[model samples]
Target: MILEYSNGLHVGGDSVKAEEIPNSKDRKYYILARLVDGEHLSYQRLSNDYFISRSSIAHDVELIKALLAKDNVSLGFDNSGTFISGGEIVKQKVIKRIVTDLLRAADDRSSILKLFIDSSSITRVEEIFQKQVQSWQLEVPEYYIDDIVISTAIVVDRGLLGHHIADAKGNQLGSLLFQFDKYPLVYELIKGVEEAGVYSFTPDELRYLSYIVIGNGFKFFMKDLQIPASFKSKVKLLISTVSDGLNIDLTQDTRLHADLTVHLYQMFLRLQAGTTVINPLLDEIQENYPQLYGTVWYAFSDFGSDNHIAISDDEVGFLTIHFQAAVERTKSAKRVLFVCPNGIGTSSLVSAKIHRILPEVSLIEVVSQVDLVRQDLSDVALIISTVQLPAQTVPVANISPMITTHDMKTIMNRYIDVSMDGSEQEVDFSHIHSIPFLAKDHVLFCNAKSRTAIIDSLMAMNEWPNAEQRNMFRQTVFQRDTVQSTYLDNGFVISHGDPSLVSHSCIGVAILDKSIDWMSNRADVVALLMIKKEDRKSVEPFMNVIMNGINNKDWFISRMMEISEHD
Candidate 1:
């Protein structure tokens, strides 16, 4: 069952061979495990054990110390050397992190656990945990299941070592997470572990274990999930922060607010316990949705700092997925009004063609030319017509009566252009972001060596109401850059400050003589966007322009560079 849960977690790791000398990552995990397992380790002792020098071992220990400090866990020194000393809960957090790292590097989780825990103990715990989750018949996400398995094993390993929580009295309210009699999963698992001669858990320990389950995202399963009013407010603040930064009103997005409130609350529990669930699509999400990812990261940073909780990039990435969905939701579409002027037989043919080709159009209303004049077109997104319709307010796709192959392709392209799923839509390569951008006077070539120089050069070209406002805009740009570099994979950085700080909505472009290293990659061209609150187009379609422009680089760069000297 454990193997079933651990079948295919591919978190970018090479298979770690035991015969090979441990790499820095592997060595760090081993050393951290030893310290957490009550082994007093010193530089010289570690040096002798790994046949490495004392200096190297000291470097590793120093790095390990910094990592533990971030989690509020301390590396303590005594007459017996050095070991990690923190509350039992925090220690388990460290243990879970270590286990998570090891899991990333190996396919066989049980083999990895056997290094620190007895094989028999791991097997018994895996069986009990699997049985309980199965009994609940819950469809838990695989990434979540992986997280719980690590945490559950950690509880058994650490609890039996006599390092149990002294008193879970403070968490008495939280112990209600698992009503042992009603929800026998946690209760039965603990009992089974002790019966299998693994470890005897105290009442406090039992309560702590319930938290372990909850921390690993068991709260998502609780049918009577009650979110505190205070947490809901924080969730709203988070949404508002991102909304303010983007200049888009998401407050009215009741579904977004509801979904995000739940997600952040679960994330809050995970962060408070120093537990993190790996998001497998993190790389793809951050890459494809860089702006959304950066905005969410900045918002979450504030949310965590305000609430005194630490947020991980993984958590930020997860929340970004929710917001991305929310942003797409804002691109609301109405029913597609299919207009057919031909006979009923032809109208039926057109309807069948659309249903077969454009499966994305959920609702299709076929209207004759007579009905088109009288029908309320307010709710229609698109009009697929067999004949020309004059003075149409909605986008009209006038196609051949037969709806040829070319017609299907053209209509699909048009549908994609006006759709929310426009990221995958084809963009015209020759089309420059000239309209509304007003970059002719601002776009200029530069010999800048650094990103700051590029930003400074571009900033000087823009009109600011005052020095204070200029500094405020600059600060926001840098603040966003800190969260995630605006560097695109195509050697271009689309930099933008907060929209509200802009006195006049404008954009500036800089093409450098040489490519300098931007945070993620190298960049030669940088675009600074200063959008005022009223300018809802936060460099929209332009982002798509930059992304799709990657294939036609020479033409795109030459075109953008030429914009500098445009009249």
Candidate 2:
């Protein structure tokens, strides 16, 4: 074994020399860890253990004390020994810091398990947990089970080490656990730990274990936990804000409100405990559904400010799942276009009859056969035409010149259960380009070498009416990125600003000189599609066209190559 330093000083020996002792930072960390684990190490004791002088240990103690003081913790020495002093809240913060380092050190699943569980005892705990899960028939998401297992193992490990939580909060949690202690699955979990016989648990310790179970989305906790009304009210208010902002009605969904309220309640509890929740589906959700992620973030970004509890992206991702499910629950209005062959009178009559028959159908517009062929009916759900027309992608309802009851009934039956199945079709980008939002002038050929530089150059265009608008747009774009990356996998980023900041929506094309690690993805970012706020959802179809083009290898290469050459 050898000791080495950054300065290339190496001593080849079995034991480290006095001069090769650990640095101040390392010594402080060791002392802090010992104190966190409830070890009362006096200056004399530390000096004797580390083969260091009392003076050296005393200096290290002062350094550690200064560090602890910054976080409102204190180091004290008495006749008993040296100890770290702080309220439970501050102590929990320090514990969280230690746990974070340990988790980081455990780079693999096996290593993580070994950190808090005996290798021989792991199989026993696994079998007990698995059996209980099977017996309860609870559909716990697979990703969350790891949290439950790890948390339970830590409780058992700490109990054996005599690190028991006996605070008021712990007592309350324990009493709550006792309410359902008779439940078979809960009993099984407690019995498994008790049967190990290596450690004894206080009621408070048991409650701490139960808290872990609940925090990880256990069904047992939901049945027994009583959420405060105030928290519920805050969640409901947030839902309302989200509903209004997205223009999606969510209040009528009682189930959604209840579910969101409960989830937020548990999230707050976890935050207060300084515990981090991990979401396995975060990457997939962010990539595949960027719009949903953005909307959920917009809705909840203010939640922390109003509630005094910070919410992380992991928690936001979990909330996004709830909102996505809720959005699926709301019935979307069906858009229908009526095509009539004859004059306005006949089309009007047909429209009136169709509305009377199917009230759920929202008639988009009345178009003649010739007019309908020229119109972009991409948004149309169903087209009811009195005249025979050419074959098209959208489902058509062909009826007689005089709309009859049988024809109406036939049309209703054929498309009643119809839903937009997200089938891709050819899109025309002519109108999108024609929109005043983007033009040859709006397109910039920047020599910028980074994402931020390219974005700044694009927003600096005269297209932004004023400096205030430009700054506002800049903030909005970066804020969105902070929530989730706007960079797509196809080597292009589509960034946008708040709708209220812009007079009209347009896409800005920025051909970067090179892509320099935009959101940790490397590529020559060929273009940046900047969208204005109001046009976010409205321009999605156009985006779909762009994405489809990018996904097609030939189109992506030729188009981007053409733009690159021109620049």
Candidate 3:
């Protein structure tokens, strides 16, 4: 029989009977009392905890809920997250179900007797016979009594009377008939034996006993007889008894792998009860069998928590310090160069102008076109020039003769700066004077007339004796008009290339005595052209440094433009 529990009692039999209800009443009452005492019970939770079906628990709860509602006693859940309603009542009902079922199983014998008898009348006869049957009058040998009890139980529980009739030797029943008749005699033999005692059995031995007594013909006969309601319970009891007798060492058997332990435990609970007994068995295996312990431990090792910590504070700190040093080094240095067409005079004039405007920066000596072609110009940052030099040389800043002091300041301040204070310093322009002739490759000096006229005159000369070169030079000078000589809002333009294509390397100077309308803006300034060759790769590095230096407001460009007109 599949036994279920509500309290301490088993709730099932071959057929459920009304007489078993009172046995479960105490549990039901206790459940009601607990509900009144403020404990909540959920049908699903109880079902899972008890290994019974939710439907069964729900039925029991419904009965309790209905009974409690009858007395105008309202059961309700509280806002404190507890089911204060019918907990005690429900728990009592569950207990009642268990107790009642247990008593029903213990008292009912008709259901047990019908297993051996086909006719219902035999059930009554068995009951009467049981009452009149003589109890053991004296002590008997344990083995003999055990044998008699087992045989009598089988006959009485299985209704073996139905199996008794004429055999093949039909004269009169012989030894087999006597054996059947003597079942009561065996019953009397063991009537006084204690109900509870410990026994053991191996699984194999239990299997053999089950096959011998319950398999094949016996199974068919029991089914045919429409046996007692309690016949299933008796069968279960017999099988359990046989299993206990076998005493199998289930723990050491590898056939019972750990993965199947839960399933095996559940099966055991269905057949018997209690899991506490399995603990000692497990401990014994763990101690005696190292291999099993190792395997199980290794299998579950991934689930173990790891608590290792890794540290790298020193390495990270060192890397951060090194990077900061590199950045600071780059931020402090500035370099520049000025270039023109000849080694004569204009280069010196422009170089002087640059130095006066930006005193903080170190300026390289001005070089003429020929000198620039001959020298290694790799380190130069800015090349101020009137002519287009070789590509891949340096960054160039181009300008016209009209460049003024304000224009120079604007160009330098917009593109380059040099200061260690980390605060912006403006370019100053107060001490500047007119030199008679600033000479390097070409001559440059302040005059009442335009400097462009002198440049045009120089290009027309044939004193160098290269006719084609002179013509080319003249064309190059004229082409400067293509830049429109217009002063933009921030600076002035004085070149032929597209403003967009011209690199910012060229420092354009604007020389103005008074504001004059040159294009749309007012200006009459000297623009120092800082133009590099169009194809210089090293130009970017130069531009980065010079632009940063000149972009500061306090720098050289303003100082150069502040030169006195009278000197």
Candidate 4:
């Protein structure tokens, strides 16, 4: 018998055992009344509310569970307690199934089925049929039932097919489909139109049609017709049919020139659709008709359109400023020396102004000509000097004596920082003890050849007093030349590799008293050599300090002239 159980009681049919079932009528009424009042019931509270033991309530719950399972219905427990699960239609199915079963028990299955089918309960009928088919394992033939009924129901109940038939040219199609809670009946209708030889349509027309199909179902003839290959031709026939039905005269109206206008609209739609097939067709048309393609693509092109305007002027300017600032920041290092002629107070003012602006830079006093000649400053990293010092001296920034404070800041920031915080102190080189110079019997002068021969000869001769001391000497003098090629402007290439110069363990100095017609700059130079193997390492640091120290323009010139005079 068709009896539906809700909670713990039989609801619809007489076949239920009332004595075995709990009287859930009061419970159902109470729960429904509470729900109506914006209150909900819980399973635990329900047990306590009825004044029944929990086990008795559990027993009643089991019977109700079995009854609901027969109709594929369920009850769920949440913060609201036991509630009917699934859609409203699912609950309706349980009720309808019970009614149908009761009718069957009364031997009225045919009348009940007829009543269900005749009613506007298409969804209920489908659900009942599906349940029966599933339960009995019946093979229901496809196409017997109404496809539109099922499809439309699914469309309305659950969103589907919306994306397929949306107006592709419209920007909000994605957002609209996302909010779609119903199945896309309109999309299906449009697909039917496509099937009925109306594939081509203007975007506006498609949008209008979409609204119509969604609001009202399509006409029977529209659904029945098959699509033609030439959609424009089909659309012309349609427009003509409509015009004829309305008896409208369109002799002067180009819109009534259905074939041409419809075809153009269809082409516009295709372009917006971004269909892959159209691109190849366009390419072929251009190739076949070069003059037409040229007119369309180039000659008649509108350059004044908003899309063609240059858009990045402000953005480019912003990027240029950002890059300039970054480069200026990167150029700023620490330690600088300023050198200029005396009596131009501009250097002092520039240095003072730079110090005020950039506390990070330490402004050393400007060195005058006298100071540049006599100052023994070898610790400076950058020399910001207006005076033209020789290149061998140091890396210098040549600035005018009339330079502004801002210009001085720019120069100091570009080259090195003059004012550094005192936390980072300068390196102290005071602990490195200097060794006394030892006299040697045999001295070797290197022009160019094998340095290895010179080293070997020095070791064999033992001319230097100590091996340890001698090795240090060789390092300072010989190995330094290997790091960089030594070239003198006097056409002489002095390197440690000369074999003729290898027989000594002592370093010797040679000087040219006058400028030689030797190389590009015509520089006559003083030459120095080291001839000891054990002294190599010690000799390197010593030479580095001396060469770097003598790189001061005034100091180098004075030392060179002193050697030349002695020679």
Candidate 5:
């Protein structure tokens, strides 16, 4: 006979009931939690607790050990039972993942607390956190409250179980984040945790709790004003360096300055707390925008050293995103010509509406259908008309008198692909950087004896799909070099190939351990601007950056030294 269970779970035996049923995933989580909590979980005890067969429990333990190994943790056996051995940070990550997965698997929020923490402890943390946020009159997002509470619960559970972040026996905490150290609200939150009387936090744990508070979408009103002076100055210096190196003045862009300052403040705090924010687009950015990535990486030389901290490529990728956006903001908007068969008033309305919808685009002119054919169409990047138009080189968008949401999306998607002027348009440096081509790993410092070895080394460093593609890329670069030297006068060469040779647009840079001769020019550094032939325009801005630097050799050499020194 078959049996049914509450909450839609099921079993095949008549004897099994809702309360008695067990989820194998839940049991695995329980086992992991026990190990993480420093409990001696033997096969016998786990089987008895879960009312599962000893064999089944043993299999689950082995599966968990395999999983732990993936996280750089080890599950070992002793005379007593099973024990877990790993650094505190690794343990914390595993524990958090276990709780999170359980929460998702159960499709219930309370499952995590029931499995790892008591109701009273959960209630105490929630109440104290709520009162503290309220007392401080801080505006934290409503959804973030649950995350804050969960993080607090994990801290309390781990702290009481002897996984202390202060003593941090097997783990190293991030360098002390000074920005939030002196905040009065942080002290209040600590006081609330102590008042609970169930557990106390060390200074580091308290700071971490504050990190939880800030990390979960809490935006302080004074965040902009609170930017550390030294941090701001360093960011300014870097931006200034890039501006001077590329001859593109970024300082005048107040919007970029303000936005970058705020991002750096939050990023610095996270770094200080040893929490590295993950950038999902790191790989794509590295492969596509190699030049921009290398340039930005050079920009922030004092990033980790000044704070006495080590920064990860993930952090550098995040910073690249901010600077990339800033560069795009400075570019001229793509010009689009609007047409209407109706009177000028209707055309004017369409123009105004399109402007509101696409603030990034410049509405060059409003022309009648006849005028569209008659007027100079050479300047137009796109043609938006109420009526159908004759054959045209530029993209023609046909829409109603009033542009709809669908119409707006159509224009945005097509505009990027269709350059207004038929022939390849002059590159918008700001626009090209919008989709990054370089990642941190693509740029490297190499010790090569000759130009050929350096080229070979770079080809090996870049992760191509196969050896065939690498050979083609290497041959293409060499063939091009033979035709005419790609070397610039100032100790550098810009090596590149047709788009078909490269899977994606990227720039790989190598600061040679020693100088090498290239035809007539002798150089120690080489930049390979590998791009898909279709994306040849992206090379223009980078070439301009190098040539601009070439104009001021001292400026270029100084920047190159910064890169070599960091290497």
Candidate 6:
């Protein structure tokens, strides 16, 4: 084996090098790790161990003090020597952070983990944890399980060394202690560790461990876990916000609902405990799925600020996977368009009949064959037709005007075919050339510095006949924006208001002179999409254009700006 340094590579054979001192940077980390592990420290004693002067130890302590100050932690000294001044939980957070920073990219984490426990001890803890998880059929994200194993190992190591996490203070997490019995995985894992007789735990210590269980994605069984109504409401709001923003339907996606409910609950508990898992695929998720990632990020702005925890990009990356999967699951979300050659009376009657029988389909469009050619079929998942006079790309279900039970079954089967079709659809660039509301006065520039300012500037440009309607439109859009922002990944925003409140469908575009903070992200371009209640389907063209702008930001925005400047 050989070791490489700035000077040169030194061919070497493994032997005792006890006299060789670790560099100052490595030495400081070792000292800090020992401090985090509840070790006694003093300049005199430290100098004895390192064979260094007391002033040299004092210099190291100053650097350590600066690092601790980042977390509002400080060092206190007395006649007995030096000690950490933060609470017990804070120390655990430091330990967990150290472990995370070490294990983020390491193939073998046992080296840094040895700061808390030996290699053999870590192995023992992992065996105990894995057995409990398998024996109890406990489901947890593998990322979180690794953190739990390290945390449990640290607890055992500290306990064996005559140091225990103090828990005599009134417990802030007592409410969760009861869940250990409800969630047997918690009890079984802790019991398994105890049975080994490696470390006995007190009542307070058990309570702390119980919290560790609940916070580390142990609430895997969603049906058995008791979720607060408020959390359920928030989840519903999240789905609705994303649905409205993307112009798609996900309200009936039970899989998305179930998975998000479980994931978010555990995420909240983990955040409250100050423990976080790193995502190795965060950059890839952010880059590949920019639109979905941005939607999820903006959707979580209020939720995070309200809870006072900045939702890290890694957490957002984890959540984007669930939403992206739901998107694929719902791609063939059938948008049945019932067309009849007859007038409005007959077409409406037949379409209403189809909807009445298939109550599961929330949206059904009633259109005449004459109007079918004018419709935007980019988002139409399936079409039900009474007249088939031409060949087209979209799959059509031919049925009589007086729809029967057999017709309903046929439509259902066709919907299944469309839903399961994995063939990809190309981006709809046909509508980008003729995007609506591109007049010079409509595509106005603004010098706003905030979300509220930009929204106000854009709203004032809308062609409202009266103040009452304008105020109503403004209030609805404002309230929805409060619930979930409409910012996109590439610094573009697509905010909309109640379509019924508008007399006509038109877009008000805002081009910011500079980027403004929009919720948790930034935005330099804003589009106010206002549609009439009857023109809901027409919004597809506008969405395609917005997506093109997000995906091809430089060219799209520059062209739009040039057109705006010349128009």
The candidate that wins on TM-score is: 1
Better of 3 and 4 by lDDT: 4
**For model 4, how does the per-residue alpha-carbon lDDT over 1-567 read when each residue is reduced to its tens digit?**
111122334332334354543355333333332322223456566565565567755555554544444333456667766665654334333333433343335464342333222223345535543554355453433321233233222222221212122233454333332222343434544344344442344444345334332222222212332234574454344333223322332223344443333333322222232210112123233233322222122101111011121111111122222222322343435455677665557766767755665566563656766667676556555676666787635566666666765666657565544332212122232422331121232223334234344345544434555676656655643443332223321223333322223345333333334433221122233333443333332333223223323234344345434433442
Stronger candidate by TM-score (3 vs 6): 6
Ranking by TM-score: 1, 6, 5, 2, 4, 3
Cα RMSD of all models vs. native, in order, equals 10.1, 14.9, 46.7, 43.6, 15.0, 13.9
Model 5 lDDT, residue 375, Cα: 74
Can you give the lDDT of residue 286 in candidate 1? 58
- Give lDDT: candidate 2, residue 277: 63
**lDDT (Cα, tens digit) per residue for candidate 6, span 1-567:** 000221121212333234444456555656776677556687887766566789888878876764554333567777767877666666765666566556674576553456545546567888988887787686677877777777777677666765677853344446655565566666777778889876787666666666666666645532376778898888888787666656678888999998888778877766655545556677677656655665666556545644545455567788888888888876455577888887788887887887776687777888777778888888787789877747656888888777777887888788778765533345565445456555555676768887777777777766888999988988877666554445555788777766678996777778788876565455788988776745544555555556557767776667566656663
Q: Over the stretch 1-567, how does candidate 1's per-residue lDDT look in tens digits?
A: 122112222111344234544566556656775676667776776766666788888778766765564344567788778887766676777766655555565466554454455445546677766776788787667677766666666677666655676645354346565576755555665566677676777776766666556655545455565788987888887787778655678878888888887677776666544556666676677556755665665556556655656566667778888787777777656888888777789888888898888887778888888888898878887888878788888888889989899999878877876674424334454547464564677877778888788888888877889999999889877776654446544576777777677888777877778877565356787878777745643444455455445545676577776676676
List of clashing residue pairs for candidate 6: none
Better of 1 and 5 by lDDT: 1
Better of 5 and 6 by lDDT: 6
Show pairs that collide, candidate 2. 499-533
Worst 10 residues of 5 by lDDT: 1-10
Q: Model 6: residues >4 Å from true position, as ranges?
A: 1-86, 97-101, 104-113, 159-164, 167-173, 179-184, 202-204, 217-223, 308-310, 333-567
Quote model 6's TM-score: 0.51
Q: Tell me the whole-model lDDT of each prediction, alpha carbons only.
A: 0.67, 0.60, 0.33, 0.37, 0.61, 0.67
Rate residue 257 of model 6 by lDDT: 90
Q: How far off is residue 443 in model 2, in Å?
A: 19
RMSD, candidate 2, Å: 14.9
Q: What is the lDDT of candidate 4?
A: 0.37
Per-model TM values vs. the true structure? 0.57, 0.46, 0.17, 0.18, 0.51, 0.51
Q: Residue 120 in candidate 2 has what lDDT?
A: 47
- On a 0 to 100 scale, what is the lDDT of residue 261 in model 2? 81
Candidate 3 global TM-score: 0.17
What lDDT score is found at residue 556 in candidate 1? 58
What's the best-to-worst order under lDDT? 1, 6, 5, 2, 4, 3
